[model samples]
Target chain A: MNKPGNLIGWLRKKLNGISRLWIVECLLLLAFGAVGARLVYLHAGPNEVRIQKAQDASEFTKSLVPFRGRILDGSRNPNILAISLGVHDICANPQMLTAATNTELAVSILSAYLKMSKEDVRYKLRFSDKKFAYVKRFVTRDISERLWTQITNNHIKGIYLEEATLRSYPQNNQACHVVGFVNNAGVGSLGVEMTLNSSLTGTAGVVKGMRDGKKHEIYTRRTEEIQPIQGDDVILTLDQQIQYFTEKALDDAMAQHSARAAWAVVQRCRTGEILAMASRPAFNLNEYGAETDMSRMTNRVLSVVYEPGSTLKPVTLALAFTEGLVTPETMFDCENGSWFYMGRILRDYHPYSRLSVADIIKKSSNIGTAKIALMMGDEKLHKGLRAFGFGRKQGVELPYEEYGILPRLEKWSGLSCSRIAIGQGIAVTALQMAGMMSAIANDGFLLKPYVVKSIASSDGKPRFTAEPVVLGRPIDSKVAALMRYLLARVTEEGGTGTRARVEGFKVAGKTGTAQKPVPGGYSETAYMASFAGFLPADKPEITIVVVVEEPQPYHTGGVVAAPVFAQIAEQTVRYLNLEPTEPVEGAPGAAAPAP
Target chain B: MARVNRKKNTADQQIIPPRLILTVLTVIGVGMGYLGIRSRCEQLGSEIKKLESSCEINQRRLENEESKWAGLMTPRSIEEALTRHGLNLTWPRRGQVVRIYDSRANDLALVDMKDAVRFAELERVALNE
Candidate 1:
């Protein structure tokens, strides 16, 4: 053995290397345990929360648009006036679309699909720095499907589709004013579209889903999605057949007379339903934006107001008959078609020296009507006229309907009473005139005029319906009967409205040729020729009002407007199948419902 | 040269337990189970998304067909078609129609034609007055 100190020193030297190795091995084992612990924490601990948070951060919400409603006619064979069709708006995220991809190939395919030039497509794709861009809009269903297939098959990144709707008026311009059209921004701009827009455009839907950092939808992680609710449909009380016929008649009248404008309204006599309302200078709903003349877009049935001229004679005579002021056999001296009343010369188109009350209305004599008004006085005339649905909105389902001017009794001028008696001083709308005549045909009850019949929800269940609202009875049934009989005589031989007679049917109507009022007096040339009439006079079915503004060659209501009324009436009578009745024997002076 | 030569043989003689090996296998099996569940969840999400999109597309198609049918039946289009094909149809008159009356249905009497026919043909038809 060696010394103790020497032995200890030799053993320590050998263990020194081993001690360093053991320290390194312990450190290595500790690192492995720490790494294993970290892995477990990441995979099963707060990592799940982080992953969910990541998904939430990448999520986005999208809005889905709903379909707009349709407008349908009231005919048994309903025709669509306005409808909305589904379309797609082709869009792209510029950041993901054209960068680092086959730019040429993408541009070429999109260009062909969009019918755009490849250079244009490429330029648009390259120039936009925005994340989103509209490539094309209002893409049809056929083209959209093809494009969708192309994009999906080629895995076109960033290019997307947004659901959009397109409004279509298949009638084009026929009944356009009533159906109206959607604008470039898809808002209803006129007529029924503007009137009932809330019911037409439905509520939009929302969708919540997760997207990756690349703005790609993580389809599996969708949170919430809702289908959009579609809009309610509107059914109108307009008969497309009658509307078409009325439009055709007005169009022909406008062309023939070189008139500034023309309009017509046909209403069901008993129900007060507006069968048809049409105005000329109408624009196409499809190209409504291109229509430059603002006035041409006006629906003149309730908008335009003018003096009704001789048409007021029937109203005056009805008032007299209602008040027991005159009988059909009572005579009035017409002063040979001219008479000075309240410092104004009241004249008739034809000179009549003496006319019974029935002949006075049948001949539409101004002096006779003025004399009768003089007998009744101003307050009575005003009350009678107001009761006839004048100077009030007919409550029709249309926009901007006017209550035509009817000055109060206190505001009557010196000649107001006499002049108004001849349909000159007062003004009335075409719809009002039609409604007034319909009341007479409906046996004296003034029914509120309405166009929209019902509104149905998206599921085809009716949400609201309109029933006939009777305003009031302006006359007794007996007086209305006498009035109808007197009106029938106006369409007989030697009467002014003989041109308005329909074959196989005894027609009843009055002619009004109102001279447009100038600054100081009436115009010598400008006139509104109008005829208000009903057919099968014994039992009236429909009332028609035809007005032609400023006829060129013939300016009289009898010549210009009466023939148009005849054309419309004949067709309508045939369409409605009104049977021929035996002509009542009156001998030119009898009234009182042919009793 | 080294005193550790005999210690190695003893260390090498010790063997791993079956339970420890089973534990290792169980950890691997749990990891694979998590992967399988995650993959299945992703697949189900994709299928749901596809189904939703399909439902939406079908709704769109239905709406589109309704619009098409309505547009095709517009009066102007129908009139154009009628004029284009030279149909030249007109409304039938009253005389052109023949009435096949059912004696059981008294409601079939012609409208606005009662007085003249009823009074004149009273003795002609064998019916109670």
Candidate 2:
């Protein structure tokens, strides 16, 4: 091999022979290429894969309204009686809409979907000066969806949809009283809405984000986002089917009897769950604003107080039985239809010289009822009725509920006891009368009436649930059973409420044909005909109270209200599928009695 | 003599060809130019982010609307619509339903299976009665 030094010398000589111009050219080209690559990266990388960032200060932010919750029926089916829907509030960016090619086409589409006059909608849209104006607010999601589709398909620009909630009653006027209505200003006003306002009104959301000039959110510039907490939905104890039937019956009765008003309440005997409570002259929850008469807004069943007529007899007799004063078989000497007692005359519809205590209730003998009241004394009678949830607030989940007028025992005169005994002096709400009857049906335990069943989260988890709250056992269970037995006789042949009988079910009820109290004395023409009853006498499932105020012509309870009671009870029993247990002794067409 | 000269020329050309070198530089310059264009598209990037957020909000609103619309088309509403259209459908009477109670199981069953088995029995009873 050659010497190592000779190879090194050769290599060095080759490198040294290269031209400086060529070397400089290569170096400069490489350097320029590197710089070019860097420039390309800095420019194109931003355009191609630019990182998201906060937008410039030319953006807008808005408040997002949280949706209100639903009011459903009881635990079983949980049908939505009241619900909040994200209705589309169709707003027009008037400047953009006026600049559009087919603004008329868009306006016509909007008007048809919103159920508005096209001219009105066109007027709202033609204002080029307005940046934004409402064409229609709170249109149903159904109509809005169709409008949105039409807008998108036709490319009819400039109309924007803002998310908003509308309180909608899907059943319309079915349970209008209980479901209540919401104000145009987006607040609940009456009934369950007023009672559970806080729970129904949800927290609103605030978004501190940049928006474009076109009112679109600039997500990159978002600073603060507080998500809304939606409201908890309330569930009610009302059965929609039962409520519908009760309303229909009451409507017919009110119209047929030509009564000033009518109201009814149906309650679960055991739980005090108001299955259906309605008062006619009722307004539609959907069209609540259109109804000018505010009198229809009152829940007459719970709000109006009047003399309950003979419905109070069973309650008084139960008090007497509780006091060890009189048994059901105790005899009373009626002064043949009319008797002078304590300077006032007490009269019966039919003259009876002698009537048993049970017959006193059956005939609704005022003289007999007064003697029973006299035996109990004014103080005992007052205490008994009060214990039955008469004078005090029944603690129902309703606003503006009245506790009917019951005079203090000290204010009562000698005539007051006798008058009160006949259900004339004491003023009681239809609800209070129903509750007392419910006590008898519920083995004398007066439970607090509740319309709200539970409040649930969006995920169907219960936030709150109503438990059966027992107010008191006003009378003994045995006394209640005995009262049920005697009241059943009132619906039999020759009794006052023979018309109250259902074909299949044994009806236990009391009829009341009280004269409406005028400014001076009671009105002879105007009467509050009422029938309070429960069916399947031995084991009652439901207790109903029906009252027709100021009924015309045939105003007796047996005549005006009893037939309606029969219709309601029969339908209700069939709906509930309570088997026919109590059979008629003699029937035109009878099935063999069950063992 | 020609073969020897050609081999020497190939050996000299091995020092890095001018064509190859210029091609690589041109590629780098074009890549840098494209990157510069991409960096200028900040508005488009933000627009994409906004579109994504808008899509999310729209999806939430769609869900809420769908549920409400479904609820509005309940059986009762449908029936009312039918009634309005003059198609009358009466409510079932009590006798039509043959309720079977299983007391041992502590349950009740409402059986009326389409004008068939249970319904046929009801019809037969009706014709006989």
Candidate 3:
């Protein structure tokens, strides 16, 4: 029994040792197999989404918005009319505020700095389920700084400031319509702002890199970085000094006449550069959205159209002179101020029996001017008017320019030639009238008006420059010279536009008091009083046009509009320091001031 | 016999290779230099980040100041200042204005009489009309 027991014990020990070895080997083999499988799977696996999610957790790509450009006024040392200033949007992360966080204190502090109600701040911070909420947008720098200091000192967890830009018009309503205003969506809405939006908006940049727990970029681990390109700055042809003078004059006129609206344009005759263009009832650009009436935003100088009245008379006479149909000396019978032609009565403002062509213009005789148009006929007149930039857009650097209504030849009635010659049956913009006067001023060459003078990049590199563009030569220089001489007489003692005379300059211009066209034929009470002309007629420098809409009791163009023209011309000529074409009273060898 | 003993003593001394030692020393030196440069690069990058942030803050402040200056420099503000100061100013009279032709500032009274007469032409048409 002892020998068998000993043999059994020895077998058990041997078997236990072999089985334990096998178990250890099996476990090691399994571990090795598992590791090998994982290696293969990692190299070529269907875990693309998982890998991307992991990468996204550690990597961040941020897009940076570039700076919007500025709008500058035309001066030797330019003034910033419209600018984009760096501002901050105060925001909050409600999720970051824990139970231990004193949210009430944060809200109280935010409301005080943001100038908002405590309830508004509390609602945004406590009740909002959103991770992010804007407390106030475009806060001033001082407010943002004070809030940041409070947050740091109090150890507030949720509040942050996001960088932003605010478009600021420093001139306020001075050149509001010209500089235009930006909408809530940060888009240029009108005038040159809308026209040059693309050039003003710059390209955005991108950065790709790793981020830390605090969401700050790990610069050393950055993979890609593309820098942003800033936008181009636009320099306008509008001189701020001249623009102020113009706006003041329009405001005075609006108050004096109790007119519904008024608009004016002052253009450099040689360059077609707009020195000053103003529309009445202008709203402050900084508070553009406050004015509920959007019609006040209309730039009437280029957008509004009306019957040109006697202002078109000079254009007609200039056309006639171009056609060689009549000289200044050509005589025509006025038929005692009224003439019946084609079933319509053409009448002059004052009675005249007979007058030469020059005297007809000087006296503004409607019958005599219409007789000359009758000789030209409808075809020649329409063609001639088209050549003079009528019934078309002058392509100025402004939006909503109206093509003043000149009917097609087929639309002309039998009396069209007679009536149109007297500045009826034709609609025209103030810009067109100014351009026509500019043509006469610039030797019969019609120039395209432009407001933007030049564009420069953020690096101060010139991107574009606007030069004087001659649209067409509607009349010969000889005819233009003769027309200028004829128009100059309108500001003389016996002419209709005598009020338009500048004291030290030879003022040449025409006045129009057109009755507003209503649903029937024309309004008996409402009239548009307008004057279009230039100064120093021999060497013209500037052309000015003033239009007052629906002026009370006094509605004559000569009485209402011409004085405004003279006021603008006098100041502008003095500001430009133009050579005195007139003699001084006391200077040696000089004559007295003009009558 | 003594010289042979000296030679034997010299032969018993161990020999070392200069080239092998130099190669190992160069490898260790290069490794230490690479580590130093890498550490310096990281320090510079951190400094650059700080500077960039400071620059951005300064730029924002500058823009704010410039915008405020522009607002104060507007024509309306100047006019208001004038009114506040009670400064009564007017445009110079025609006779009082004297334009400098070219670079010269000669007295108008002493200028060529013919030039002054040419200026007189402006008034002639007023009487004629």
DockQ winner among the candidates?
Answer: 3
Score each candidate by Cα lDDT.
Answer: 0.81, 0.80, 0.85
Q: Which stretches of candidate 2 lie over 4 Å from their true place?
A: A1-62, A93-107, A125-128, A148-158, A206-226, A584-595, B1-105, B109-129
Predict model 1's lDDT versus the native.
0.81
**Candidate 2 on B1-129: residue-level lDDT in tens?**
445555456666678888999999999999998787666554675677679668755755765564565356555566678988999876454345443434432233222111112211221111100
Which portions of model 3 show Cα errors greater than 4 Å? Answer: A1-46, A94-108, A117-128, A212-214, A587-595, B1-32, B102-129
In model 2, the Cα lDDT at residue A516 comes to 86
Which candidate would rank higher by TM-score, 1 or 3?
3
lDDT tens digits, residue span A74-114, model 2 = 63556777777666789989999888889889878987888
TM-score of each: 0.80, 0.78, 0.86
Best by lDDT: 3
Candidate 2 whole-model C-alpha lDDT, 0 to 1:
0.80
Model 3 lDDT per residue over A68-127, tens place: 788999887889988887889998887776343587788788888888899987776664
TM per candidate, chain B: 0.54, 0.36, 0.56
Ranking by lDDT: 3, 1, 2
The alpha-carbon lDDT assigned to residue A89 of candidate 3 equals 93
